[model samples]
Target: MAMRKLKHKQVPVWIRLRHLPVELWTVKGLSTVASGIGRPLYPDAITRACTRLDFAHVCVMLDVSSKLPKHIIIMMPKEEGGEITCKIDVEYEWLPPKCTSCMTLGHMAKVCAFTKPSNPAIPPVSVLFLKRYLQGHHPCSRLKGWTNRERDELPHGKTKREYRRLKGWTTSERDESISCRPKRRTTKERDESVLVKEG
Candidate 1:
C-alpha cells in the first residue's frame, strides 16, 4: 500500500507592505511581481486580486500573506521591467508569538502553563572571580610569556592586594590602574609615521 504523505496546512499571517509604488497598488500589478519577493497570502495570490478583506475605501489592498517569518521583497514594474529599483515594507505586527514552553502560538514563556518549575537560585562562584579579574586582581603569574616589564607594570587594587596576600602571591606598590596603561603603537602607526617623515 502506498502511504500518502500528509500535507501540513500553512497558517496565513497578516502583513502590511508599505511604500509599494502607487502603480503596483492594483491586484494585477501586485500579484504579477509580489511572488518574486514573498508568497502572497491567498484567495487569488497569483492574480493578486484584492480579496474582500484586503480592500479599503477607494483603494485595493493587495493580499501580502506568507508562511515565512520575514521577507525583504524586491519588485520590478510591468512597464519598466528591471530598470527601476524600489523597496516595499512588509509588516507582521499582528502575528502571534510562538511559546517556547508549551510549543504553541499566541503566548509567551511567562504566561505558559507548561513551563517547568525553576530551581532555587544560588550565587555563582565565578561571579567573584570575574569581579576580581575586572578589578585588576588577576594573578601576576598568569602574565607569563609577557614581558617582565609588563608583568611588573600591571596594577592591582587594595582589595586585590589583600586577596593576593591571602593567595601568597606577590603584591606591589606599582600603579594598579588598568585604564591608565599607555597605548602601544601599532605597525600601521609606525608605517604612517615613516611615510610622513619620507614625504
Candidate 2:
C-alpha cells in the first residue's frame, strides 16, 4: 500500500476553471469550487484543495488527470436549483454534443441512423408548430385577411379564394355539423330502449 501510494504521488494532475465569474474571485467562492471538485476525484474525498483562485480562473489538483470529467457542477448560494437561480453555465471541456435521438454523444440527432429522416415536403416551421402548438391548424397570417378585391387582382386568385372560403367556416357551421353527427347510446338508454320494445 505504501509503495502504491508513492507511485500514485509521482504523477501530478491539474485543471483550470476559465472565465470564472469576477464576483466569485473571493476566498469563500474559490474554496467552495475547489472542495466540490476535490470530493469526487479523491478516493479519500478531501475537499480542501480549492485554495487557488487567480484572475478569473481556478486551478484544481487531482490524483489522475486522465479520468477528468468533461464538466463540473457548482452550486451557487443565491439559488438552490430553482427556476430563477443565477446559473453559471459552463461548456464541457472535452465532451461532444449529445444526440438525443439515439441517446449518444459526439454527434447531434440530425444525422442519426436510428432516427427517421425528416420529411422534405413539410416546412420546418410547420413541423415546429405541429410539435409545439396544441390548438388546431392556423393558416399563416399572410393567407389570412386576404380581401376579395385583393384576391381578384392577384394571379393566384383561385387558390386564395379557396383558402379564404375554408378559413371563413363559421361557428354555426361547426355547430350544425356537430348536431348532424350521431350520438353514442349510453348503457341506461340502451336498457330503456329494450324495455320499451318489450312493453
Candidate 3:
C-alpha cells in the first residue's frame, strides 16, 4: 500500500475569531480608535463595505449576545468636514489599584514610597520594633513595615475608643444571659395575671 500522510485539520479564522476576536496586545489600539480617534481598520466586513460604497459614514458594529462589553459599543461616524475619516479602536487599559504609599498604580516598587526619597527598604525588624513601641493589641500591630508616622505620633490621651474595647463589669452589664430568655415568668401561677382589690 502507498504511504499515506495523516492530514491535520485547520480551523478557519471565522471559527477561531468566534472564540477570541482580538489578541491581548491588540486591545489598547482598539480602545483609542473605537472611542472615535482615527486609526487602521480591523480587517473585517465593515472595511469592504466602506471600500465599495465609498460612504463617508462607516461603523464596525458588534453582536453583543456574547456580551463582551455589557454597556458600550464602538461606532465610526463620518466627520462633518474632514479629509481623513477612517477610524480605528484601541483597547482600554484597566487602571490598577492605588498605592497607599506612593498614591499611584500601573507601577509599584520602582516609584513607591518604600523606595522613594523619604522611605527606604522596609525591614522585618522595623515592624517588630513598632509592635514594641505601639503597645497595641490590634492584629495590624503584628504587620510588617514602618509605622505611618501619624499613627506613631498620636498624643497620649484618654479616648472613648480605649473604653469601647473593654468589657463593662457592672451587674447591669450582666443582664445575666437575658436576650435568649422570655421576659414573662414561666410558672402557671405567674402565667395568670394577678389582681388586688383596694379595701
Best candidate according to TM-score: 1
TM-scores of the models, in the order given: 0.33, 0.26, 0.15
lDDT (Cα, tens digit) per residue for candidate 1, span 76-149: 54564655666665555354565555555666778765574567477767876675564354445344433222
TM-score order, best first, reads 1, 2, 3
The lDDT per prediction is 0.45, 0.41, 0.33
Instruction: In candidate 1, list every pair of residues with a backbone clash.
Output: 41-65, 155-176
Superior candidate under lDDT, 2 versus 3: 2
Q: Where does the lowest 10-residue lDDT sum fall in candidate 2?
A: 4-13
* Regions more than 4 Å wrong, model 2: 1-5, 9-14, 39-55, 77-199
TM-score of 3: 0.15
Task: Provide the lDDT at 136 for model 3.
Answer: 50
Candidate 2 lDDT over 1-199, as tens digits, reads 4552122311222444554555565557656555544432321112234354332233444333234454446544545554432334332223345556655444577877668656657645676566323222342322344332343323323322322222233224444331223456667655554211111
Relative to the true structure, candidate 2 reaches a TM of 0.26
**Lowest lDDT block of 10, candidate 3:** 10-19
Clashes of each: 2, 0, 16
Please list the Cα RMSD from the true structure of every candidate, rounded to 1 decimal place. 19.7, 21.3, 23.6
Q: lDDT, candidate 2, residue 61?
A: 45
